[model samples]
Target: MGMMKRLTAALAVATVLGGGLVAANAQEVVLRSADTHPDGYPTVEAVKFMSDVLKKETDGRISIQVFDSHQLGEEKETIEQTKFGVIDLNRVNFAPMNGIVPATIVPCMPYIFTSKENMRSVMDGPIGEDILKAFEPAGYVGLAVYDSGARSFYNSKHPIKTLEDLKGLKFRVIQSDLFVDMVNALGANATPMAYGEVYSGLQTGLIDGAENNWPSYESSKHFEVAKYYSLDQHSQCPEVLMMSKVSWDKLSPEDQTAVRDAAKQSVTKMRELWDAQEEKSRKIVEAAGVEINEVDPAPFVKAMDPIYEKYADTPELKDLVKRIRDTQK
Candidate 1:
């Protein structure tokens, strides 16, 4: 009888241990993502979509928690954090990465992309793949790219019908030398500032104007302060989704593929959201009585020639620039 009791106890203990092992194997992983845009912004929503895709693809074992509205940090700060693995994922404009990642410089060049479709074609093709590969050496795994509609200048001062209208206006630019030079070349005072500070800068008269997409202008409510928006469509730089190499290296090979696939699928969702948001934001700003104008892009394009020469200093950048321009859109 005692021998029978010992066998039963051993069986019960083995069952409990087996259950614990299964539970350990099924542990959930939630990656933390950061974005400077506010919650429900197209990019933020897209990341949420990515999370859904990841969760479903991984059978609920993997997911993402996004912190938007500078919750983690601004673009520049988040870039560094993501590199160090303090942030698992990041969505940032190409401008901040230009100085650190040479591949990004050409893409951020003024007038480099002729239109949204042109930009999308170049980035969705081989050229874009090359740029994504470049991120690895910079401690990031390039996940996907999203649209940042054509950026144009808007000011609290007056209409910018000509280059003359932009002169002497203190404009807020991302913390990038290219942006500074671009604004200065157009004869405006370029004040390099964080994205979060632009609204307050406009309201307090600290900056005479700033430049961005319609969605940004409306979402940030900058349209209320800077009523004059000129559609020169200066830069069509795309936003990038990135994963920290530190976090990526910790994932299994299968999970890595799942994450990459999920991010890629999220791009389609992002573009759809982006198109609708752009139109919605445009209507919202127009309804708010913001004076919008369309300036001849000839002078604006001409002013960027020197800028192009200055940034495409290396053979690689020049080659990339030529290929992008020559690419059939």
Candidate 2:
């Protein structure tokens, strides 16, 4: 009888342990992550960082499945899907988000940030927080910002060494009034088009030039078609990683903490990657026969001053710009 009682106790303990293991396994959550960049880009690296950290920190309770090269869809479609709760997360350029949250356009205005450090200070500080807050009403929870280096001009026709050089050139631009106005102020015909079509458009001579960072110009091989890369560095539009409000609301407080912590880590890592990648990209483009010109930015800055004036009527935007200019150190 004593032997039988001991066997029964051991069986009960084993059953409880097995049940606990099963319960823990059942708590797993799978998330979907989407971005427009191709697999080998630095943007994809940042997404992977978030995925790896989240899985490890959650002890495998959560995992992110990443979609690169716009496998899910374009920026607009991805954002719409996120808003409708069909997707969990997406990394978007601020230009597209401006459509959903108009206030986001404020940051993309020409010359809003005079230097990379100034831009970093604004985005990593309270001003960026305020911009993030503007997205909540549109069903997004902004997590972190990824650097999309400063925007500059590239053309097949001529090197834009001065504002006059840009005159009458057809320049491709994103569908943002801020971009349009800035390009217009420089005397170029701003042609708004989707990014995927830029290479072909430039190749076929449908457009004379476009503006983007060094990495994008190199990676997309736009340097092959457009020979001149003028470093105007007119605007610094950082991409944002955002979560679906529907998905975020479902997370327990502990899981929310894990996600936020992972996002912060990814942002810091991305900045380091961006700085390194920008240098690498410049070398690559130069090797590919792209002539890089470092023009005096003062003329460009002076030409874009009207953009600031256009927004000056609004106290919030004016004050925000003042604060950013003051915060430079």
lDDT of 1 by residue, 75-161 (tens): 777787677666789999887888778998888889888789889988989999999999999999998989889999999989999
The 0-to-1 C-alpha lDDT of every candidate, in the order given, reads 0.86, 0.81
TM-scores for all predictions: 0.84, 0.85
lDDT of 2: 0.81
Best by TM-score: 2
Candidate 2 residue-wise lDDT, 1-329, digit = tens: 24344334433543564411122356887677778888867778887888799989988888777789986666777787677555678899888886687667767777777788888878889988888878899999998878889989999998888888999899999877777888998888999999889999999999999999888888888999999998878889778999889888878999998997898789878888899999999999888888888888778878877877884447776776677777764
RMSD of each: 10.7, 11.5
